[model samples]
Every structure is written in C-alpha cells, then in structure tokens.
Target: MKTSPLEQTRFWQAQALGDIEMLHARYVQQRFAPHVHEGYVITIIESGAQRFWHRGSEHLAPVGSMVLINPDELHTGAKAHEQGWRYRGYYPDTERITGVLDELELKRCGLPIFDASVIQDPQLARAFSGLHCSAEHDASALEQQTAWREAVLMLVQRHARVRGTPLPGHEPGAVARAKELLDSLLACPPSLEQLAAEVGLSPFHFARVFRQATGLPPHAWLKQRRLGRAREMLRQDCPPLTVAFALGFSDQSHLNRQFKQAYGVTPGEYRRACSGH
Candidate 1:
C-alpha cells in the first residue's frame, strides 16, 4: 500500500490589493463539483497536473501553465497526476480587471475575456506567481499594488486581446503633494485610494506617476522613510519596541526583518552599537 500526500488549502483576502481573494492549495483526493464563479478565476499550476471540465469538454493543465476562467463560467476540477496538483489562484471580480484597464484608458469593446481555458506563457505565469507570493507574504502596499496592475495589463494584452493606449503624462505637482501627505502620515499612512483621491488622480494612475517620478511606489518610499526614522530614534537610545510602534511596523519582529533586510543588522544590534553597550 502507498500513502497519499496530505492535502492543504489556504484562502485569504489580500487587503493590500483591495481585498482580492487568493488561494494556495494542494490536493490528493479532493474533487470540485461543477460550479460558477461570479468573478474571474486565474490559477497557475505549480506542480503535478489538474484535469478539469469546462465549456463542454475536459481539459488538462500541466505544471507551469495557467488556467483562466471568465466570470460566471461553470467548471469542475480534480487531479490528473498521481500525486495531485498544487496551485496558486486569484479570484478577481469584474471591477478588479476593468479598473486597471480604465486607468490606462485602453479602448475596450466590452469586458475582456479569455477564450482559451489554459495558456502556456511562461512570462505571464512567472509574473502572476511572483505577484501571488508577494501578496501572500504581506509585501508593502505600493509594491503589491504596482505589481497587480502590471501583471493584469500583461495578461489582458497578451491573452485577452486588450489594446493599449498611451498613459497620461506626468503631474509633478500631484506627485509632490502626495509625497508630502505620505511623509506627514507615516504612522498611519493613507491607502492607495486615499492618496490618489487627495492628489486628484485615480489610484492606479497615481501609483504609476509616483513610481515614475520617485523610482519607488508610494508605500515602498514610505518604508524607506520609516527606516530612516527608526535609525534616528535608535541613535537617541529609544527601545526597539518603541521604535517599531512609532514607525508603524506591525511588531518588533516585523521591524527586525525590514531592518535586517535594509541595513544588514538587527535593530537590537544597531541599538547596542549606537549606545556603546
């Protein structure tokens, strides 16, 4: 007798990406009944293979391929490989897809659709996989937001046949004002939407503009500023916990991770060196 691999499933909302739902799952014995999703389903097969039923036919999705289902489509899923399949999936409503297109002012005859149920574009697969990992790990809002737009644009252009138009030109004044706002609200920074609204631009457009001008999206830029402030506080003998809370890190561990990544030293070590301890 042979043992089957254990099953695992995680479903969560990515608040950084406007609360879009995501899933990372591996299954050996599970079978999905015929169902319809009100939103679009985009999934990448990471290992093994998946056999699914859609549009009156059975389909196989091997590893490194992406399965795309448009909104309100019926589908069924099960394992096609002996060991089962592990996949990362994104469920985005019509607004999530259209919103990115609208920001670019792309001409659209109707909502974008994916005629193919599965695709073998390695670039797109890698882009979406990385985006899923970033969201799963709670990356900064700016990085996640910017990545989501770029990935969706690539998907729509390559697979969904969405044509592109030139993006809006830069607005230096708006970028400056947005930066000031972010600087002032470091402890409780505004969301992408809020920052955009304050600067009189759409959220995605504002993110683009900020990235173009600053070489970093709003949240990433804010992170650098926070780290700088953390260093200042540490030099003044502030405790690590106090610095973490004051700089809006989720916890001391969060601060430690970011600090080490940026400065190559833990917060405690930095503090000790500064205090001559």
Candidate 2:
C-alpha cells in the first residue's frame, strides 16, 4: 500500500481567495480515515472508482462523477479498483458557498444540504472540474470568480437544498467604509485592526461583514485591487518595477506573480500584448 511517485496528492492553498481550498490528487493505495471538514467538499472523480462512507451509508463515485459533501459531514475514502482514482476537488467555507447563493438571489430556506452524494451529469462534472483547475492554478481573479460562482449555482439549483439556518442579512455599513479605506490607501493599505477601528467595528466582525459583502476577505480584496491597478499601469507602459512600488507591491516579482495570476500572462508579456508590439 505504498503510494507510488506517480500517485500524486497535491494540496493547493487558496491563492486567489481565502474562502476556498483545493486538491488535485491520484491515489493508488492510500485510504482516508474517517474525517470531517468544516466546509463543503465538491470533488470530481477523474478515473477508476472511489468508495466512501457518508451519512451512515457507503457510496461509490465513478469516473466523470461529482461528489458533494456538506459542511461538517463525516466521510471516508478508499480506492475500489486496482487502478485507483484521480480527482480534482474544492473545499469552500459555508460563508463562501452562501455568498454564491446570495448572488443567485436564492431566498434562504436553509443551508444548502446536497441530496445526492454522487452526481453523474457530464455537464456538471465538467463545470466543477473546470472550476477546480482554475482555482488550483494561477487563474486570474475574474476567471476564477466566474467559474466558482457558476459551479456553485449549478450545484445548488440541481443537487442541494436549503435546510439549515437562514442566510445572513444585508451588507453592513462598516463594510462600505472599509472598502473606501482600502481603495484610498492602496499604496500603504491599513491593517485589519486599523481598518476595523476606523470603521468602528472589531476585526472579526469587519472581516465577516467585508467577506459577506464582496465574496472575498479584506486582504484578498486589497490584493485584487492592487492587481487591477497594476494591470492598468502595465498597459499604460509603466515599468514593471515602478508599477510595483506605485501599487504597494513589495517589488517587481511580487507584481509579476499577482499580474500573471489574474491575467495568465506576465507584466512584460501583457504590456507587449497591450501595445500590439
């Protein structure tokens, strides 16, 4: 039961947004012990078969199928075939999934509890898989957000139900003020506590309100804003290093990484493309 080198298990940190986590893994002999995650788990099985225990029963997820696990649900996983199983997965916190529900204007009957453990729809499988790929890679913020929203909407409309607490209320007023601060202080952004204090809220409440309003945590929002300004500056033929300092990025490389993550091209490449040179 030793895993071969080809049997990869990669954990991807949420690079674009703080609300999601991802994995692209292939397992030959590895078996997961019973565990629970505090968020929703949507997995697309790529090959072979995976057997898992959930909700007091066992389920099989074959290739080209999607597995949906609700928040805090217990589950286990093991290969059912000799060839093993490959999958790309996303773990989005309750707030994140609910934000999508809010955007879709779905009135909250409750939390989204999936009725099906394994879904075989090719279209949904493809959509979820594509979202995973975008999230796990250096996909641009707009690209990643679009995919995330689409996938969540499909999952909720087709497979999940509202059977928990009602959704949160309106975006707080402090959130608006905090956003203004971030916009005004791009070159020297305020810390969470500092922003919270100026907005007359605690750090925790400020962060929650901000995320509930924008679908991204405060720091992630700042990064996105920085990237947006950097794109504009880069297109205007601003030097990469100069754009970095102007936008509060630490340096040229930092700017480059963020630029590439959002646009799928480096600053230099983007500038040339913009110039038609």
Candidate 3:
C-alpha cells in the first residue's frame, strides 16, 4: 500500500519587501472556495496545473504560467491535473504596487489593472520565480528590495500598460551621505525608506541614484562593505563567529557563505593565511 503525498503550504511575510505576504504551496486535493484577497494575487505555477474561476470564466494555469488576479476579485482554485499543482504566490496590497509606480513619478490616473487572468511571458515568469526563491531562501534585504521593484516594474510595464517615466536624476552628495550612514551601521542598517529619509530622497529614487553612482544598490554595497570589514578583522586573527556578529550577519555560516563567494576562501582559511598560522 502506498500513501498519498501530503499537501504542503508555507506562508510568511517578506520583511525586506515591506512585510508583504507570500505563499508557497503544493496541493493534491486542496480546493479554495470562492473568495477574495484584499491585495493583488500574483502566482507562478511551478508544476502541474491549477484550474480557477474568475470573472465568470474558467481558466487553466499550467507549468511555467502565471496567474494574476487584481485586488478584491473573487476567484476559486483547485487542481486542474491529477497530480495537483505547486506554485509560488505574492500578495501585495494596492499601495505596494502603487508605491513602485509612484517612486518613478509615472503619470497614472488610477491603479494599474491586469486585463488577463493568465499570461505566458517566459522572461517575467523567470524574474518573478527567481524573486520568490530569493525571498524564500533569505537573500539579503538589499537584493530582495531591489529585485521586488524591478520585477514589479517589469510586470506592470509589460502587461498592465503602465508607461515608463524618466530615469531619476543623479545626486552625488546624497549618495555619498547614504553610503556613510550604511557604513556606520553595518550591524543594523536602516530600511530603504529610512535611508532615503536621511538623505532627503524617496526610497526608490535613492536606491536608483545610489545604484547609478556606486554601481550597486545600497544593500549590495552594504554587503560588500560588511565582507571587507570581516576581512580586516580576520586579518587581525578575529574568530569567524565574532566577525559575523559584529557585521550583522545571521551567523558564522552566513559569513562563511558570503565570504567564500566574494574571495574564494572561507573566513577561517583567509585568517590563517593572513596570520601565517
């Protein structure tokens, strides 16, 4: 006798993405009643297929397809294939979408809407899928935040009819100041909004300007700075654990992974080499 595969669901908030809700689910016999979400529903079907009803129409979302539902829309969901479906979903409120558009100062009369329930853009699917994986795997806040904005911008521009606005102008002084702040607070960096406020720029605009000036987003820059500082301390024979804690890494392993990725050697090995141990 064989047992049925158990359904799995993991729901969590992406604190880095403004605490937006996310879902990763695999369903075999699960069924969603006709219901509505207070936020927009964006999902990428990873395997199998899902059948759902929305706006008096039935739709099928198979592998490599995306299901998009605007806010407050009633929809129902169940397996479209025998094996069920696995998907990663993003639930962001109207403000979250609008905020991204607002950052670029796009001239829009109202909220952007998705005219279709399902789409098959491979590039978009890859972007959003990669984003979901990054958030799930605890990617750095800077990376997550940057990816979120880019992916959302792409989604709206490609499908929702949102037009592009001019790129943000440069602000060298503000960029330098923001970097100083980030460097001073490596163990507990400020959020994007807070960092922007410190420099008199909006969060997204600051991020764009920082990227333009430094060739990296604030978070990525912070990451590099942290790794650099770790190297300095390791050269002084500091332990990996101490380096991790001092630089705001999650743990020694976290430092190990990033340090190796950057310099091709673990902190311990680097420390040994520098000290001639």
Candidate 4:
C-alpha cells in the first residue's frame, strides 16, 4: 500500500481487556494484497464502501454492514467508492471467542464458522460499533466487557454455524494455583511461558485451560487484577503515581488509562468523587 499524505490507517491493540486488536482506517487509494490473519475478523463499515475478495468470490461491504472473515481466510481489500472506506474492526482469536461462546452456552462444533462474508444487521452493526468506540475511548471495564460479550453472543447465535455441546471441563486446582501466583506477584508477574511452566502446562495449553476456568487469558486477567487493586488504593487516597509504581505500571498515565477504562472516570476525577467533591 502506497502511503498517501491524506490516507489514514490507525491500528492499535484494543484498549479493552481481551485477545483482540483493532483497526480504524480510512483508505482511499490503498489496495491490500492477498493476506490472511490467524484470527477471526469482525468489522463494521462506517461510511463509503469496500470491495474484498473472500472465499473465492468478490464481495461488497458498504456502510452500515458488517464483514466476517474466518481465521486464516485469504482476502484482499480495496476501495469501492470514491470517498474510500472508513471502518472499525476487531480481530479476536479463537480461544477468546470460544470463551465468549461458552458463556452463552453455545458449542463450538468444530470452530464457529460464518457462511456469509457480508451481513446487514442493524443490531449487530450497532453492537460492534459501540464496542469499538468503548474500547477506543477507555470506557469502563464492565461496559467494555459487557459490550464485547453481547456483540459476540449476538453474532454467534444469529450467524454462526455450530453444533450444540457443553464447554469443556476446567482444571480448577491448576487454575487456582496460577491465580495465587499472579496475586502473590502483583508488582511483577511472570511471563506467560514462565507462569505456564510453574503451573505445569505448556503455554498454549495453559492459555486455553486458563480461559476455560477464568473467562480471561492470563495477560488480561493480570491487567484486571492490577486495575482492581488500583481502584482499592485510589479509594484510600493513595497518590496515583505511587499506586502506579506499586502496581508495576509504566507510569501514572498508564494507571490512569486503566483506571478510567474500569471506572469510566479518570483517577483524579475518581479521587475527587471519593472525597465528596
């Protein structure tokens, strides 16, 4: 893709907790070469239109429609309108998605698959759009988490093709040990590999089982734990910067960003509110 001074592609790991990445881009002249992502792609078009080659066919996803690209599917993207296409997208791994599905009592027959590449559902569109905004703007953790689950549930229930079965059993003892280690070292948690080793499992296996037990991956669980601790300390009137250091955050802004994401208010504002301001 040739870089145009006016073209914009803003990509970031989604600010919310989960195994998700985000892209909010406006592309005019850029054409994406054939590519594949290791995770499922869910996107809602904001304006203009997109022409994409998917599943051996070319398709159009215009404004107000959602695009579903299954994992490892080869696809290409290019503008379909003069104004180009503006969209917000989320790429979530299979494990994270399955975790969400399990919450809804939906079974992953093999892997949840989508037959339609382009879908026009106002409800799903609104749900995904809201999730994208909440994640981008650091909405409350509860809000972001709720939006994510709701959107995924809606999508899977309505669009996915999967057989009905119960989620797998969890290793409660192993998961508990892992949680203990995490809580014991809140300031400097171990790497995923290291944690998995300590818990006597491979990293990938640990991740899958951990999500089964806790409804979150290790990294996201640790983040939420830290943020939760930050909230307790903040309520006690601890200095935000000091709390940041104690919680092993990069800085107060790091703590602030997370705090806002969990509480829908910045640390300072939260402090003032707690002080009866």
The reply for model 1, stretches above 4 Å from the true place, is 1-5, 162-277
- How high is the CA lDDT of each candidate model? 0.82, 0.77, 0.82, 0.78
Off by over 4 Å in 2: 166-277
- Of candidates 4 and 1, the better by lDDT: 1
Question: Where does candidate 3 stray beyond 4 Å?
Answer: 1-5, 162-277
Looking at model 3, residue 5 earns an lDDT score of 61
Task: Count backbone overlaps in model 3.
Answer: 0
Residue 164 Cα positional deviation in candidate 3, in Å, after optimal superposition: 18
Model 3 per-residue lDDT tens digits across residues 1-277: 1213666666666878986777787887666655555579999999999999998899999999999998656677888989999999998888999999999887797778898999999999999999999999999999998999999999999889543343544448898799889989999999999999999999989989888776567877787788768977986899999999999999898998777544334688767755647
What is the number of residue pairs that collide in model 2?
2
lDDT of 2 by residue, 103-199 (tens): 7787887688988889888988898888777766678988888887887788788887778573454447798788788988999999999999999
Which stretch of 10 consecutive residues in model 3 shows the poorest summed lDDT? 162-171
Per-model RMSD to reference: 16.2, 11.5, 16.2, 11.2
Expressed as tens digits, the lDDT of each residue in 1-277 for candidate 4 is: 1346656655555546563667677778777655556578899999999999887799999999999988756677888999888899887778778988777776456678899999999999999998888887878889988888888888988999963443544446678899989988999999999988998999999999888876568877787778767766866788788899998999988887666433334677655534434
